[model samples]
Target: MDKLKGKGKEAVGKLTGDRRKESEGKADQVKGRAKDAVDEAGDRAKGVKDSLRSDDDR
Candidate 1:
């Protein structure tokens, strides 16, 4: 969502020649990607923990 919003803002900034908006848009995209990475890591950790629990049952 943030990435999509950033893309739109970046496009608009380019059309309107606003340097600040363009930089902000770029920052938003980076933030979105970082959030996605953290979420993925958390999910992987949960999966590992679940597997460990199942192993204990056996």
Candidate 2:
């Protein structure tokens, strides 16, 4: 996962005193979180759509 990789990179950056790597790692984590949010929203939408279809059939 991006978050996991980011954590590793952040840790290594801190140990090696590389600010760029640390920033990149932080950015990666944010991106991963955003992606997760979008996926969750899509799933929720699908659930709503399915429920509506079932209700219509009934």
Clashes of each: 0, 0
Over 4 Å off, model 2: 55-58
How do the residues 1-58 of candidate 2 rate in per-residue lDDT, one tens digit apiece?
8899889889988999999999889988998899999999999998888788865575
Among the numbered candidates, top lDDT falls to: 2
Task: Give the root-mean-square deviation of each candidate in angstroms.
Answer: 1.9, 1.8
Lowest summed-lDDT stretch of 10 residues in model 2? 49-58
TM-scores for all candidates?
Answer: 0.88, 0.89
- Give the per-residue Cα lDDT of candidate 2 at 38: 94
At residue 49, candidate 2 shows an lDDT of: 82
Residue 52 of model 2, lDDT score: 80
Q: What is the lDDT of residue 27 in candidate 2?
A: 88
Question: Clashes in candidate 2: how many?
Answer: 0
lDDT of each: 0.89, 0.90
